[model samples]
Structure formats: structure tokens, C-alpha cells
Target: MNAIQFITQNTQLDSKSVANTVSLLEEDCTVPFIARYRKERTGNLDELQIGAIVKFKEAFVALEKRKATILKAIEEQDALTPELKSKIEQTVDTTVLEDIYLPFKKSRKTKAEKARKNGLEPLAKIIMAQRTTDLEFTAGKYANANVPDEAAALEGARHIIAEWINERTDIRNQIRTQLEKYAQLETKVIGTKKDDEKAQKYQDYYDWNESLSRCPSHRLLAILRAESEGFIRVKISIDDDRALDSIDRKVIKSNNACADQIAMAVEDAYKRLLLPSLSNEILKQAKEKADEAAIAVFTKNLRQLLLAPPLGEKRILAIDPGFRTGCKLVCLDANGNLLHNETIYPHPPQKQLREASKKIASLVDAYKIEAIAIGNGTASRETENLVKNTPFKRDLEVFVVSEAGASIYSASKIARDEFPNYDVTVRGAVSIGRRLADPLAELVKIDAKSIGVGQYQHDVDQTKLKTALDTVVESCVNSVGVNVNTASESLLSYVSGIGPKLAENIVNHRAENGAFTSREAIKKVPRLGGKAFEQAAGFLRIRDAENPLDDSAVHPESYGIVKQMAKDQGIPLTKIVRNTAVLKNIDLKKYQTETIGLPTLQDILEELEKPGLDRREKAKAFTFDQNIRTIDDLRSGQLLPGIVNNITNFGCFVDVGIKESGLIHVSNLSDSYVSDVNSIVSLHQQVIVKVLEVDIKRKRIQLMLHKG
Candidate 1:
């Protein structure tokens, strides 16, 4: 099948839609741009659907490339029979194609090759035919200088037959099918390391055996991790007797001495060749499935975290809480620019709570701080208590921001460039403050993996993980429009077509030529051609621009349609923007053209009604249980308010005002079967969970979602 056909079949999308999407992808159109702007051509396919087409299209291309390589290799050897070439060309499954090419594949010398050189192939064929009942007589005829005795000749013939049995596609497929359906993945602890403290984390996997087909992705990844860590040995197995019998039924032709010889060869092939190769292949497929699953979980968590509620532009006091070292505090303006920085020891050896509180209050009043953001890290609880008790002249909202990747951000090159004169602590405080103001903008600076909302992210394929995470970041950044004038280069880079170089050029241009007052002004940036502008224009918002739609999602190309609507209404553009009555009365059917369909027209109308509207919700203040400061103070069934910090395939981790986050397993998420943990809770979701059990020694807490 062609790429369009393959994508249509695999994704179950309409063939026409798949073809159109492929064309757009081939034309270098970004997924977000095509989904948002070119919906009419794609049959209104969403970003996820477009992403699916991209994935399957790449797979088909890879398959075709592999076929060409295989065909060329076989042709070079003059072994490319018409039937074999036809089979290779017709098959799309990579496994089946590899099986067809296995016999022709060049490799190092083997026993079978040695036997063939010893002139034992004729005897092996005769034995395989099963026509001669006297195998010893037949073997003696083939015995020569290389094969000294009848036994040695028969053994050599058996080796050649063994290679033939291994090369038979049907037998290999039979064993592979068995392994896929019935193989058991077993793990056992290394005796010498059983008592090691680190190994205790994976104790549940030690001496464990489960059906490979039935094992969940999380468990399999854990077992693989344990094996990688030298804590255990993993083995994949199936019933050998059953596999041998299946192969025997397929290969053996008659009930005679030749049949016995064939059976022996079958046994040798399975034990020495097929089982090991097919078993590893099956296991690799399982690991791939697990990697995809883990990456999906991480992608979802990262998306939700990136699009988490933004406490829009607000001047604030951000604190990186600590103990004996003192809490590092920075005062940031509404734009998140650090105006001042200082350290105050509210807790620890100094115990200068009065002085710290006074300093914070003075800074809030001095800097006109609108909100107080405290990092939920070391000494978070104590610092929170101090902030709660501090006297302020005006009511201010206080938020505890997740500091998961703050440390990584502190030492990053982006942070250094942004705050060249500040230390790591100051940069960390700025990140916490900026994260509260706009999550999508600030989180894009740090690597998504360091954000800590993943399951086995480091264990999965890093390249795939990075690609998936970057896709999510791009989707989130574009979905919520960026203010082009104020956005950081890191944030701008994720804006559809504006990559690192273009982002740098845009930043440099803005620095040289003031804020972008109109979308047309952006085209002037060096190295930013028309295509980049086309993909990124709608998603880049310009505040107080000459044209009102410049700040909205309405693409500049569609400005004429919007202007005609305003002209038809006999009203100015400003009156049409955000004017619900005018927007509602505007008939979208009148604006639909050959290129602009109902989908694009409807999007334009919505963008007009709420220009530059953020897709994320507004941030709110949440307080955890004051009495529950530590794990030791928790009791069974004690209700507590928490925020989900991380989510995985198995469960989600909730921060409940302590260092150790509690886990709400999939089983405890609901009484019914919970197929997806995300369906019940999301990253940074405020939830009320009851303590089910607490293992203070292990620093583990089990929680159940409270219905109330």
C-alpha cells in the first residue's frame, strides 16, 4: 500500500482525508497549523488525528526503504528468485519480510555452511525426503574424507537439515505465534544482591513470573529496569514440548528413521536457533509497546502540566523555601522580570521568623506585590506557615508552586542568559514566580523530562520520548497563543514554524525594533520567510496593535473575510471584536468560500468574540491540611486536600503538604474499572483524598479518592 492507503488503513481515517493530510505534511505544513488553519482540506481532522497520519506515514516510508535495501542485498547475491522477490514486494509486515529474507542474509560461517562445504548436502536432502528406510546405508554412501564415519556423516547431515528447518518461514512463524501468545516473563533476584537496600525497591519483581501477553506496561518496564539495574535476571519462556510438537507436525513427512532424523533436526533448530531469535524479537516488541505506553503517559502529564492554570500577569514575591540556608526570595514585576532579590531565614538555626516575616511584608508593600508564590520544596510547609501568619496591608492570594524542574532550570543556559548577574537560587525563585504567572511560557525553558511528571521517562527510548514531549510542548504553546512582544525565545521556538533560529531572529528583531505593533511587522525578521510567518502568524499575539485581529487567532490571510463582515454590518472593526451581539448576528455561511469552509469560518467567529482567549483556566489558591505536616501525623481515613503532582499508568502522585507525595492507585481511583488514570484526575488537579495507609518507614502513603 502507498503511504496514504497505509495511513488510512492503520488510522481508520478517510482515504481522502489521509491523502490531503499527507500532502500538507509533505508540503512542510506543521500539525498545529494544518489542524487549526487548513481544516477544510483535511475533513476537519484534529491535531491528534493529523499526528497519527504523520506517524503511520513515516512507518510506511521506513518499510519501503527496508524493502529496497533487502531487495538490493538479495539481488547482489544472485539469489533473488522471482517468487522470493514477489513475496518480498507484496508483504508489508516487517517481521514477515525479514523471515522471507533470512536464508539469503549473509552472515559469518556456521555449522551448516561447514557441513555444506564437506559435501553432506546431498545426504541431508535424501534424509529429508524420507524415501530411504535404511538411513545408515544412505549415510555411508555420503561418507568421505571430510566425514570419516556413518555417524559423523549423519550428524553433519542433521546440521544441514537443522539449518533448513530454521530457515523455513512457516516453522519460524509457528514458534513466534506461540511465543507471542503463551510466553511467560520470569524474573529472579541475584542472590548476592538480594539484601541490598536499593534492590528492595524492586523486591516485588524478584521471583516473579507472569504471562508476557498479560503483563501491564508498567510492570514490564519495572522488571526490565530491575534487570538493567543488576537486581534481577529476566527470562522469557514457553512450553518447549508444545513448541516442538507444533514444529514436528509441520516438518515431519513420514513415520520412519528419516522422520526421527527430521525430528532431531527440528529439535536442534528450535533449541539453538529459532527460539532464541524469535523470543528476543517478541520481547523487543513487548518493550516497544511498553515504551509507547510510558511515553503516552508522560506526554499526557506534560501537556496537562504545561497547559495548567496560569495566574496571568501579576507582580509577585517568589520564595525558594529552605531550612538552615534560609529562603531565597525575589520580587518580580508583572512581566516576571526580577526587580530585587534577598534571603531571609524564617526557619532553622537562626529561627528569625519575626525578621523574615517583616522582610517579606516590607517587600510586598515596597514592590507592590499582587501575589505571593512559594516553591513547594525544602521547608515549604514552614515557609507557608510564615507567609500565612505575616501581616499585610491588603488581601493577597498566596500560591504554592511545584518546584519539580526549578533546580534544573536554575542552572540552564536559558536561565543564565535571562539572569546573568543572579545566582542559581535567585534564578530558581524567578522560575517559581514565572511558572505561577504563565506555565506554558516558563515551563518551555526547561527540558520536559526534568519536570518530573512522568513514569520511567529515563528508561524509555530517549529519542522517542524527546520527540513526543516536544510535540506536546508545541501543541500546548500554539493552542494558547503567545504574546510575541514579551515571549521568551524558548517559548517562541515552540510556536509552530518558529524554530530555534527563527525564534532567535524574532527576539533579536524585537530587541532592535521595539514591540511588534502589527502581525505584518513580524515578516521583517531576518531569515523568517513567508512559510514560517504563515504557520506562526495566527498563534503569535500582538497586544495594542494597529489591527485588532492581530492580537487574535484569525490568520492574517483571512483578515479580508473578517473586514468584509465588519463592512457589511456598517460597523468599525473594534466594534465587531469582542462584541457578542455583533458576533452572534454575523452569518458564517456568508463568509464561507472555496478555501474557507464552515470549520475555519466558525474558528474566525469564535476568535473574534474572544480575541486571544487563553485555553487554560485561571490559577487559584489551594491550602493543604494545616495539622498534617508530616507523614507520621497522618492517620488512616484522615481527609486531606492535595494537588496531583505526577501521573503514571499505575497511579498519580498527590502533594499533600509534605515532602513525600501520596499515591492514588488505579484500583483506588474508583470502585469500577479505571482504564485510564487521567479520566479520573489530571496533573495539578485539586483533589480531596482520604489516607488509606501510611508506611512511615518507607516514606510511602496510600490514598483513596474521597467521593465527598
Candidate 2:
């Protein structure tokens, strides 16, 4: 098959653009680099389309490698005919190629091999021809010392015929298609473990049966996970008689003395060989489709979470709440540097409310804390209540931040290196504050899987998951340009071409020589060369740079054109950079060159109007309803405010200020049909939901979005 043509038809892009993208990918150009810098060459494809092309191109290369292996194996067997070789060379689908190679595959001693050794090949060929008469006489002629009876000879012939039918590409493909369209996935809970406490989680799947094609991705993954954990047995199949008939009709062409023997062989093949392999292939296809859907959801969630609005630099107080251990409190300066940390127990078991209130007020006044960020964990609501009741020197914006990965980050190596003198508690409190300040910068430090925003993250293919998540991070980081002087190594590591080692170098250089005054100064760092600078400079912003455009998205290569625009407009570069009035009057068409199209020039014009502007909105305060602080306090049909905490294929989990977060199934996301949960709700989106069901024993709550 022509891979490039297939890609063009699948991705709906021009063949020239797909070919150019494939060539660039072969040269080791990163997707972000190509999408951002090579728009003129790619027909201006975005990262999503470019990423698809890269994946399919790699698939085509893998297909070719598998074909070579199959061809060599067949040739070594000395049965490779010109016609067979030609067919194998032209086939593209992996399954079809495997089917064509099946008869030649080396295998353990089988019934067919033993039957052939006993001189049953002629009888088997006569039965397959369906033109034979006196089949019993033929079977008797094949009998020898190994096969001494007519019955034994007939049975051996049937085995040989079954093997031949099992390898036919036409018959296998037809059965495979039937299975794909009609198969049902079934699960049976382990009998002895039905009452086991550990197995109780899968009780709902004890006798579950669903059409494999119609099964939702989340439910399928959940069942597979349960099976992998050894609490259930799962299988995919259809009606046994129907499946047998499909192969029987395809293998037996006519009714004759050989017809009955042929029918027996077809049944044996369907039962002993073809059905098992075909069932597995059908389920494998279903699993791959489910993984794609789950990964897409995870990709979208990670994108939204990484780009969540940052509170920006501010003096803040952060709390990681607990009851017996007290709340781990820390004060952070405008840049999120840890200033002070301590523990306070204002909740029960200590109930030192008066003293804790006075201490909190004093810290707020002493540190000039402008906002309060409390982790939404144990005692989080109580802590917020206490903080809101206190009379501070300045009004504070209180935010109940999701602390999903804060503990993981606290114990991480990056946290230890950043705060060698502190404990894990202090690092965790600091993380809570920093993420509230800038989610993108703080989040990149932790593993994306631990963030708790994915559906079946641990169950999905880890390599593919990591690659996709890394792409999301890179896209978000470049989409919102990084601050060179203040960015952490983890953040800078995601900037177009710079990786962890180079990020460390940039941070060390800044510490030794001072802030980067111009984007060009980045080149002075060890090992950061022209190519790296070319790929990374536009995405790395330097605030208050010597050259104003250095802090914007306009690449350094286009600096000359921007300068000419300023010159033609008869205004100083500094004055014209942010002066929308002057930028609006200039003709973007005047700057278009052969290498630069109108797309690039137009992007440059937008950058000129908003130099170094952040794409995310400013973070706002969110509150949960006070009356519903605990699960026991919840009631059916009651309206309560919530924030979407985690999303999956089945539904979204919203935190309503309780230990158990409520689930809004995709069916309940809208009054209209909601195919994608993201279209109606997003990570951290605030809305009101009505309680549908509350199961105290299961610690689960069902919720529906409140329309009004």
C-alpha cells in the first residue's frame, strides 16, 4: 500500500504536506517545532494532525518489517511460490498477512502432521475436493500399521482436512468479521470470592454480559482490570453453533460421500483452532479501540489541568489539612519561595481554636499573605471555615485546591533538591501554594499519572500514555511561553528543544551570572547551540528583555521584519510593540516574504499587540456549600455547588466538600445527549449538581448537573 496516500486520505491533508511532515519527522524534528515553525511547509497543520501522521507513518514502517520477516520464513520452508510471494508482498493488513503465512508457520507436533506421517494425505485431499465416491474404500486404502482400521484412517483424514481448512485466509477472514460484529464480552465472578471483602468491588460484574462492540470503554477496562486482579473470569464469543456453521459452509462446497467427513473437519477446525484465535483477535481489536478512547480523554484532561488558570505571583498562605497531625502551614512570598512553615491543630482532638485563630491572623499580618490556599483533603472544609472566621489585616482570597499529587511531589527527588533543609510536609505545603500560583510550572514536576485526572491510567499502555502526556505538556508549555529567569528546571525542560539537563544548565547559569537580559544570552549557557536556540527561543520569554520582541512569540529570525515594520510606521520599536493603534494601521501584507506566509505574518502582528501576555485567565476563588460538609449531611435532590475533580469515559467526579466525591455519569451531564463529557464539564469547572443516589455502604454518590 502507498502509506503516504493512505495518510492523506485518513488525515484529509494534501499529499505534499503529509510527505513533507514525514520527511521532517525522519530528520528528528519534534512535533512542536514543526507545528510552530514549519507551518508553510505542512499546510499549517496543528500538533494533533502532525502527531497522527507521525504515528501512522511509524505503523507503515513496522508493517514493512513484519512482511520481510514473513517472506524470509516462508522462503526458508522451500514452499514460497511466485504467486504466493506476490500476494504476500501486496497485502498491507497485518492480520491478512499472518493468515496467508499460517500454513507455513513452524509449530509443535500436531494431529495433521501425525496423520500425514500415517499416509492419510490422499484421503484428506479427496474429501476436500468434494468430488470423491466410495470414501470408505479410500480411507481403507490409506490404512497402514500406524492406522490399522478404516475408522481410524477416516478420523486421521478428518484431522488433516481440518488443518487445511484452519489455514485458509478466506475462511478465517470471514469468521473474524462475523465475530467482530456479533461477539459478546462476558465476565463471571469467582464463586468462592463473591463474599470476600477484596472481591466485593467487582460484585456488579458477577454475571455481566454486553455486546463487545457496544460496551463502553470505561466499563470494558474496569472488567479487564478486575479479571487481571484474579477476581473474575472474562471471555469474548458468539453462538457456538452459528460460528461453526460459518466455517462449515465456507469449507464444504457440495453434498457427497466426502461431505459428512468435511463437515466434521470444519466443526473440529472451528472448535479446536480457528475460533480460539479469531476470538482473541476480535477482543484484541476491541481492547486497542478502548485504549485509544481512554487515552484521548486522559490527553484532554491533562491539557486542561496543566493550563488551569494560575493565581500568578502573590504572597500567600498554604495549608495541608489533617486532624490528628494538625494542618501543615507554610507562608510563601510573591515568587513562591518558602518563607515560614509550622503546624496548627484548630480542629477536634486539640480544639485549640482561639490560639490557632490568633496565630493564623498574626502570620497573615507578618507575612503580608494576600491569599489563602488550603488543600482539599481531610479537615479541609473545617480549615477553610476557621480561616474565613478569622479577622486578618487584609482581605484574602481563599481557594480549596485539589491536592491529588502533593504528597507524591513532597517525597519526590525534585522536592528534596529544592528544599534540602525542610521535611516532606513543608515541601507539600509549598507545592500546594506554587500550583495555585502557576499550575503549569508546578505540575510538570510530578508524574502525570499521579495527578488523578485520568481514566484507567495505570491499566493503559504505559509507553503510549507517557508519550501522549509528554506531548500535552510540551504543547501547554509552549502555548503559554515560559519565564526564563524564574521557571523551574521541570518547566523549562518542556520548552520546545530544551530537556532536563539543559534546563538545569539554564537555571545554573541564571544563578551564577544573573537574570537573562536578552533572549540571545541563553546561547551563552553551555551546550545550548544555534539549533537549540532556534527551536526554543520563541517559546522561552524573558521579562524586561533588552529587545522587546525577545519576550514575545515572534521568532528571532523574524526580528528584522518586525524592525522594518516599526521603521515604516515611523515609531520607535518600544512604542510600537504594544501600541495597538499603530500595529493596527500597518499592512501585514507588506511583511510577507517567500519563507514567511500570511499565516506567519498575521501571527507576528497578534504578538506585537500583546507582547508576553499570558494565555490563561487569572484564578478566581471557589466555595462549596456549607451545609453539605459531610456525606451524612447529603440528601437526595438537594442542590449543592461543586468543582469537577476527575473525569472518565463513564462520568466526571465532582467534589462537594465531602470525603466522597460525587459522580455525574455522562448520561447526566446534559439534558441533551452528551457524547463527550468535556463538552459539558471540565476539570475544575464549578457547577451545581443535585444528588441522585447516596450509598453510604459503598461510599458512592450519584449526581446530575443542575440545569437551573
Candidate 3:
């Protein structure tokens, strides 16, 4: 099949649609752009589908190029027979192609080649065929040419056949498949030459053994890490009986001397060559699976973290908690604009407690602050206590926000643009406050992986983790439209079509040209282009604009249709919005087209019902017990309310008023099968868990979801 046809078939898109997307992508049109602007041509494939088609097309082209190169390489060696050439050409998978080209491929000196050069091919063939032949006669045949002893002759013949078995592509493939299905991975810890006290965290992995397929990603990664640090050795072994039986049935039959030699040769080939290569391949595959699982967990956490409810355009005073350096406080207006900044010495030594309180009261009075956001970092609890007890107006509420990546954003370029004259600490306080205003918009400024949400996040594959988290961020940002006029460049970058550069351009254009009055003004931004506008416009809101639809998520392309519907209903667009009576009468089926599907239509209808409405609710304020500050305070059978920090393949980590979170293993996640922890719990969700076990020495806390 042609590239477009192949992509369409694999991805379940129309052939014509795939072709058009591929052409646009090839011409450097971005995914968001094509999905938005070229909807008519591409049948309105989403950015995700267009991206899949682009990736598939590239992979197909790469495979074709690799096939041609392999064909040429084989022909250049003059070992390309019609049968072999045809087999190679027919091979589509890279692994199978490499397997077919194995024999013809150049290699280092091998025992079989050496033995053949020494005139032992005849003896080797007899051994391979497993013919009923006397050993003395075989020895004589080999010795006649070199005048070697019986042992050396047998060795030479065995070496020749061993290499022959190793060179057979079919045999290797068969063995690899069998080993992958049946092999048991064995891990042993390296006994310390020194004291064993220094490396106890790896103690459990040192003697672990499990089937590769059944082993979880975290455990596998742990074992690999132990092995890498010279604290353990890992090996894969198949059941000897099954392995021998398969080889005997496939390669050897009669119990002759030749048969015995062939069996020995095959065993040697597997032990000395094939097994090691196959084990490495299995390990590589295992690592890939582990990385994917870790990335999935991280992605889920990031999504939850980003989608956490916003405080809804309220004025907030953010305090970045500190001790010796004092606290950095910044006040942000309703639209996240910085209004004031100050440093408060709320803690010891400089203990200007009254002055700190007075400064906070004045700032709150000046900005009409509706809430107080205190960063959950060093001295966070102290700050919270101060805010709670201080005699401020009873109308103001206090929240302790997880300022995980606030520092990272404070030093970012977006922060620089927003507060050019402010110090990083001051910027950090502003970020903390803005996050309370809108979590998704502010969090997108910092890297998702660095949000301190997942377990063992640093130990996972960084690149794969980053890509997955980035995808989740993009999906979340686009899923909830951003305020085009108020969104920072970092937030804008996560929009469907707009990326880092385009986001920067948008921000730059805004700074130079002032606030955008309508979504149409975005197209005038340099380098934004039509495609970028198409993907981003629907998700960007221009509140109180000339066109009421611009404030809603109704795509500019669908404006005429929405207006017509509004006119036919004999109501203003505003009345139709969020009015169930007006919305129920509208027939969505009549609007069906090749470009717009049920999913997009339903989404548009929902947006029309609640134009520019934030779907997330205000998060309830929760505080863990100060007395139970660490795992030491957690007792077995004790039930405690905790927030789910992360959900991984193996378990969920819940922070139950402790420094170290407890793990609720997958088996104990629920009574029924809990195949995925994400299905059971999510990040920042409050859950009551019972402490199942606590290993104080190991600092491990095992928790159960079944609370009594």
C-alpha cells in the first residue's frame, strides 16, 4: 500500500483525509493548524489523529528506506540469491528483515568459518544431519586432512555445527519466541565485599526472581538499578527439560554419536551466544514497558494536578513560606496582575509578628483580597497558622496550596515578562497566588514531571516521561479553554496550535499591541498564521467581545450555524446559552457534516450552554494532623484520612499526615480486580486509608484502601 493508504488503514482514518494531512504536515503545517483550518479537506480530523497519521507516514517511509538499503547491502556482498532477495524484499518488520539478512551480514571470525577453512565441512554436515555414523569414522574423516587427535577432531566438528546452528535464522527466531514466553528472570544481589549495611534499600531485589511477563515495571526497574550498581546479578533461564526437548525434536532425533554431538553443539550455541542476546532483548523490551507504565502514571497525575479547580478570578495574596530569609508575599488582582509585593518576617529572630500582621492587613484592605494562598513548603504550616489566627476580616478565607513547581516558574521567561523588576522569590510568591486563581493556566508554566506528584519520578525514563506529561498538559489546556487576553505565554503554549515560540509571539504581540478585544485579532500576530488560529481560536475566550460567540467555545467557522440556530429559535444568543428550554429544541443531527462529528458537536453544545464557565469546582480546604508529621506516628490498623498523591501501576501513594506517604498496593486497592490504580483513585483526591503494616527500620508504610 502507498504511504497514505497504509496510514489510513492502520489509524482508521479516511485515505483521502490521511493524504491531505500528510501533505499539509510535510509542508510544515502544524497539527493544530491543520485540524482547525483544513477541517474541510481533512474531514475534521483532530490534532491527535493528524499527529498519528504524520508519525505513521514517517515510520512507513523510514521502513521503506531501510528496506532499500538492506537490499543494496545484501546485493553488494554477491550473496543475494533470487530466493534470499525475494525473502528480504517481502520482509516488512525491521527485526524479521535483520533476521533474514543474518547469514549474509559481515561478522567477526567464527568457529564454523574457521572449521570450514580447515576442511571439516563434511564431518560437520554429518553431525548436523544426525546420521547413524560411527564416531571413529567421523574422527578419521576429520583427522585425514589435518592429522589431528580424536578429541581435537571432534571439537572442530562440534565448533563447525555449533556456529551453523547459531547462524540459522529460523532456529534463532524459534528459540527467541520460546524463551520470551517461558523464561524465568532470576535476580541475585551481589554480596558486599565490604559491610552490607550501606546498601539495604536494594536488599529485597538482590534475591528476587519472577517471570518477565508477570513482573511489574517498578520492581523490574528496581532490579535493573540494583544490577547496575553492582549490588546484584540478573539472569534469565528456561526450564531445561522443555528447552532440550524442543531442540531434540527440532534439530536432533536418533541417539547416534552424531546426534549426541549435535545436541551438545546446540546447547553450547544457546548458552554461549543466543541466550545472552535474547536476554538483553527481553530486558530492553521490559524497560520499554516499564517506561510506558511510569509515563502513564505521571501523565495521569499531571492531568489531575492541572485540572484541579480554580478559585475563580478572585484577588489573592500569596505567601512563599520561608524561615531565616523570611516570607515573600505578593498580591495578585482578579486577572492575575501583580499589584503589590513585600517581605514579612513571620518566624523567629526577626519576629516582627505585629508588623507582619499589619502589613498583610493593609495589603488585603488595599487590594480587597478575597483569599489568602500560603505555599506548602518550608514553614508552610506556620504561615497557615499565622493567617488563620491573625485578626483579619472574617470574610477572607485561607488555603494551603501545593507550591510544588512554583519556584521553577518564578525563574522562567514568562515570569520575567510578567514581573521584570521582581526578584525570583517575589515572582514565586506571585505564582503561588496566581495558581490559587487558576491552577491549569499557572501550572503549565512549569514542567509537569517536576511537579512532585509521582513516586520515584526521577528514577523513570526522563524523555518518555516528559513527552507523555507534555501530551497530558496540552490535552488538558485545550480541553479547558484559556482566557486569550489574560493567559500567560507559558499557558498559551499548551493550546492546541500554539507552541512555545508562537505563545511567545502571542505574548509579545499582546505586550506591544495591548489586550486582544476578540479572538480574530490573534491571526494578526506574527508567525501565528491561519492554521495556528484555527486550532487555538475555539479554546481561547475573549469575554464581552463584539461577537458573543467569541466568549463561548463555538468555533469561528461554526459561527454562522450557531447564529442561524439562535435566529430560528427567535431568541438572542445569550438567552439560548445555558437555557435548557432553548438548547433542547435545537437538532444536532441536522448539523452533521464530514468535518464535524458527534463528539465535537456535543462539546460545542455544552460550551454554548455555559459560555466561558470554569467547569472545575472550588477545592475544599483540608489539613493533615500536625502531630502525625511522619511515618513514625502512623500505627498499624489506624485509619486516617489522606490525599492520594499519585497512582502507579503497582499501587497508590497516599499522604496520610506524614513525611513519607504510604503505599496502597494494587491487590489491596479494592476487593475486586484493580487492574489500573488510576481507575480507583486520582491525584489530590482525599481518601481514608488504613495502615496495614509499618516497617519502621525500612521506612516503608503499607496501607490498605479498606477502611474500618
The Cα local distance difference test for each model comes to: 0.93, 0.89, 0.79
lDDT of 3 by residue, 1-708 (tens): 578767877899888888888888877666655664567678878867976886688778887898788889888988778998777666656678776766666354777667777777787777777764678666776675554776777777888777777677777777778777887889776665224665677777767778888888888877777777677898887776666566667888788888888888888877777778777877788888887777767777888988987887899999998889999988888898888887999898788778888888888888899999988777776777777767776488787787788878888887887788989999899888888888998888887766887756776788767766777787788777888888888888888778889998988899899989988888899998887787688889897898888887778988877777789899877677788778877888777777765656776788788787777878667776665756678789888888887777888888765557799999998889988888888888888888899999878999999645
- Model 2: which residue pairs collide? none
Candidate 3 Cα deviation (angstroms), residue 306 = 1.2
lDDT of 2 at 30: 78
Q: Rank the candidates by TM-score, best first.
A: 1, 2, 3
> Which structure among the candidates has the greatest TM-score?
1
Query: Candidate 1: deviation at residue 316, Å?
Result: 0.8
TM per candidate: 0.99, 0.97, 0.89
- Cα lDDT over the full model 2: 0.89
Error of 1 at 24 (Å): 0.9
In Å, residue 103's CA in model 1 sits off its true spot by 0.7
Candidate 1 regions exceeding 4 Å error are none
Candidate 1: tens digits of C-alpha lDDT, residues 184-226: 9999999999999999999998799999999999999999999
Residue 149 Cα positional deviation in candidate 3, in Å, after optimal superposition: 5.7
Which ranges in model 3 have alpha carbons more than 4 Å from their true place? 1-62, 116-123, 130-154, 193-198, 349-355, 412-420, 455-460, 570-580, 589-602, 626-633, 636-638, 692-697, 706-708
